[model samples]
Target: MNQRVLSGSDLAERARRAIPGGVNSGQRSIPGLTDLVITEADGARFRDADGREYVDYHAAFGPPLLGHNDPDVSAAVAEAGRTVDLCGVGVTTAEVELAEALVELVPSVEKVLLTSTGSEATFHALRVARAATGRRLVVKFQGCYHGWHDAVSLNVISAPERVGARDPISAGILPEVLEATLVLRFNDAEGVRAAFAEYGRDIAAVIVEPVPHNVGCLLPEREFLRTLRDECTRAGSVLIFDEVISGFRHDLGGWQAISGITPDLTTMGKAIANGYPVGALGGRADLMELFSSRPGGSVFFAGTYNGHPAVVAAALATLRKIRTEPVHEHVFRLGDRIRTGLSEVFAGLGLPAVVTGYGSVFVAYFMTGPARTYDDLLRNDASMFVGYRRRLLGHGVFELPLNLKRSHVSYAHTETDVDRLLEAAAAAARAQLADGDVLADVADASTMGGVADRC
Candidate 1:
C-alpha cells in the first residue's frame, strides 16, 4: 500500500469488522480501492479518509455527471425535504414533472414508471413484457449487464470457460430463469437474427445496452442495434434498451437519440439524477399501461420510494442542468482530450494499448487494438491493466484498479484536471512498463468483473 493512502487504514480496518469484504458493494471492494474511504466528494474531486485529494474519474460508477454535490441539485433536494415527505399513496408534483421531462427528452418513452434502482427497473420491464406478450423467454447479449435480476443477470463478464456456456454470475439464480434468457454476443447481428428466428414466439423481450459499459465499452454497431429492434418488432416481443449506464450520461435523450434506433422499453438510472437513488422504466404507453395497482392488471408495480419527492427533485434539477447547460459538450470534449492524451502517452512509451470510450467515459485495454467484443477483451493484459490503474491511484488519480473497468469525466472537470490526469496516467504507464516487479503487488484479488466475486 502507498504511504500516502494509509490515513483511511484505520477506518478500513473497522469497516471489515462490520461489512463483508470491508465495503458495501463488490465494485467498492476492488482490491486497492477498498482501503480508500471517500469522506468528501465535490465537483471533480473527492477526498479519502486519509485526507488525500484525487481527481475523481470513477464518479461512483458513472453517476455524478453534473459533478458531486452540485449546488442546484443539493438545493432542490433540501427544498423537497423541507416541503414534502413520502406518502406512499399517489404521485408527487415533482414526480409528474420529472416524468413529463423524461417523456419529452427520451424518444421511446411515452409513459414512465419510477423505481429506486436500475435492477428494479429492468425487473419490472421484463415482468410487463411477459404480461403483455404472454411469453417465457427473454434475449440478452454477452457482457451487456442489465442489472442484477434473475432474468437478465446471466452471461455478463463471462470467463473464457463460460463464454459460450450458461454462465450465471450468481449461484442462487433459478435454473429456469437462466434457461429463459437467451444470451447472444454483442454486435453479432447474425446471432440476434438467429435467436429471434428460433425463439421469436416464445421470446418476451430483448434487452440490450446501446453501449455495453459493463465490459468497459462495446460500441454498438448500427446494424446490430437495428437488428435487435427489427427482430423484436417482427416477433411481437418487446425490445428493451437497458440504458442504465448510457441513458442521461451520453445525451439528454440517451443513445437512442444519437443512434436513431428506439426500443419498446427503456431503463434509466445512474446519471439520471447524478448520484441520487432514482431509477426509471418508461416506454410506449400501450406497454407501460400493463402495470397497474388494480387487481386485474397483469403486471404489478409497487414501491414505497418509487418517486420519493427529494429524489425526484434531484432528478429534475439534473435534467434542468443538462437541458440548459453545455454539460454534454464539455464532458465530451474532456473525454476526448483524456482518451487521446492517454493513447499518445501509451504510443510514446511503445506500449500495446487500445484506448476506447463513448462520450464521458474512457478505458485503456493493455493488449490488442480495436476491441469490439468480450472475446477481444479476454486478450487484455489483466496484470498490466490492474497495475497501471493502481499506480494511477498512487499518483493521485482514482480509477478502480481492475481490468476492463472504464473511468468517467464529469461536467465539473476542467482542462487543467484533464491535463493532470493525463500526467498521472502517463507516469503510471511508464512506471509499469519500466518495472514489471511493481505490478505483482496490486492487492491479491484479481477476479475480472462480477458482483460478488470482484473482491
Candidate 2:
C-alpha cells in the first residue's frame, strides 16, 4: 500500500490499543476506505495526517456551519481564554448575552438553559416534559435522533420489520426504558394518531425533528407537522423539536419559523457554536421555569461547563455573525446547486436515485421514487450507496460512512466547490455504472431484509 495510507493505518492501529473500536465514534470507521486521521482544517477543506487534502462535506458531523477555523469565532474564544476560562462558582456576562441572543432568534424560546452536549440537552428536555406533565411515556418518530440518551435513543435506525417496535440501537439500555418510549413512523399522521389514541393520556412529550435528517433528510409533510402540534396540544403533551442539526442551518428560527408551527420546547446544538462544544435547551417561559431554583419545584439540571466563558463567547460570536451576514443565502444557493446538479447527473446516467433535503443539508438515496418515511428510505440500496460513497472518498470528497447520513454544505463552500463536487459525483456514478448492471440490480433489490442486515 501507499506510505500515506500506511500512516493512517498505523495511527488507527495505535488508537485501537487504547480506544475501543480504533475510533472514538463507531460511525467514523468506514469499512473499505482508509481511516482518515485529520491533522488540520481550514475553510471548506481538511488535511489528513498524510498531508492529502479533501473538500470536507462531513463538517465535523454538522457543526462547522461557518466552516473550520473561522476567524471571528476563533478570536472570541481566544479573548475568552485570556480573560475567563472557567468560573464554576457564578454565571458570566457572556452566558447571559448568549441566552439573550437565543431568546431573540428562536420563536418558541423565551428562556434558555445551557448544556455541554446535545445529549444532555435532550435528556433534560425529556425530564422537563415529564416534570411538567406528570407522565411517564414519550412519543418519538422513527429515524429522528435526539442524541444518545436512553430516553430518546430508541428506534433511531431500526430494521424495516421493526418499524413500530421500540428497539434500542445501542446496548446497555434497559428494556423498561424502551417500553416508556413509543416509536412511530415519520411523516405518517395516521400512525401518530393511532399511537396517541392508545397512549395519549400517558404521553408526556412528543419529540420530533421538524426536518428528519438522520434517515436521509425526509422532510415532514405540512399536515404531518400540524398533526403533531394539534395532537400534543390536545393531549397536553409537551411538543419538543430536536433542532440540534437543523437549527440556524436553514434560518434563524429553525424549521419552526419556516413551517409556522411552534413546539413547546426545543433543543439546539451543532451550528449554534460553529463547532464549539455547546448545547442549549429553550422553550416557553412557564415550562422552562421548572428548572428555576428560586422558588417551587425544580428538575435537577446542572453541569460543570454549563456556561463556560470561552464556549459562550464562541456561541455569541457565531450567532452575531449569522444574524448580520448572508451566510444562509450563500449556503442555500450552493445546496440547491448541488442537489439539482446531482439529480441531473443521475438522470443523465439513467441511475436509480433521488436527492432530498433542505437548505444546506442533503442526501442521495439509491432509489428512484420519493423517500417520504423511514420505510420508504429503507427501500434504497444501501450496498450500492455505500459503494458510491467509497468511490467518492477516493475522488477527494469526504462524507459520513453511514448509508443514509446527511451531507452538509458550509458557508465556506463556493460555486466552484459545488462544480467540483458535481464533477466528482458524475465521475463516480459513471464508474459505478461501468461495473456490470449495478443499476438494474439496485432497481430489483428487496428493501425489507437489507435494513436488518445493515444493523
Go through the candidates in order and give the clash count of each. 0, 0
Q: What is the C-alpha lDDT profile of model 2 across 1-455, one tens digit per residue?
A: 66544577688778778888676654655555435677889999999877778898978778889999999999999999988878677678898899989999999999999998888888989998999999999988888888777887777777777777777767899888888988888898998889889899999999998987777688889999999999999999999998988888888898999999999999998898998889999999888888853356488878988988878988999988998999998999899988999999999999989898899998899897778888887788776676676567777887765577779999999888888889989987788768734433432232211111111
For all predictions, the C-alpha RMSD in Å is 3.1, 3.8
- Tell me the spans in candidate 2 whose CA falls farther than 4 Å from its real position: 1-6, 292-296, 436-455
Worst 10 residues of 2 by lDDT: 446-455
Give the TM-score (vs. native) of candidate 2.
0.93
Q: All models: lDDT?
A: 0.87, 0.83
What TM-score goes with each of the models?
A: 0.96, 0.93
lDDT of 1 by residue, 90-165 (tens): 7788888999999999999999999999989989999999989999998888888877778877888777898988
Residue pairs with clashing backbones, model 2: none
Candidate 1 TM-score, C-alpha based: 0.96
- lDDT score for candidate 1 against the true structure: 0.87
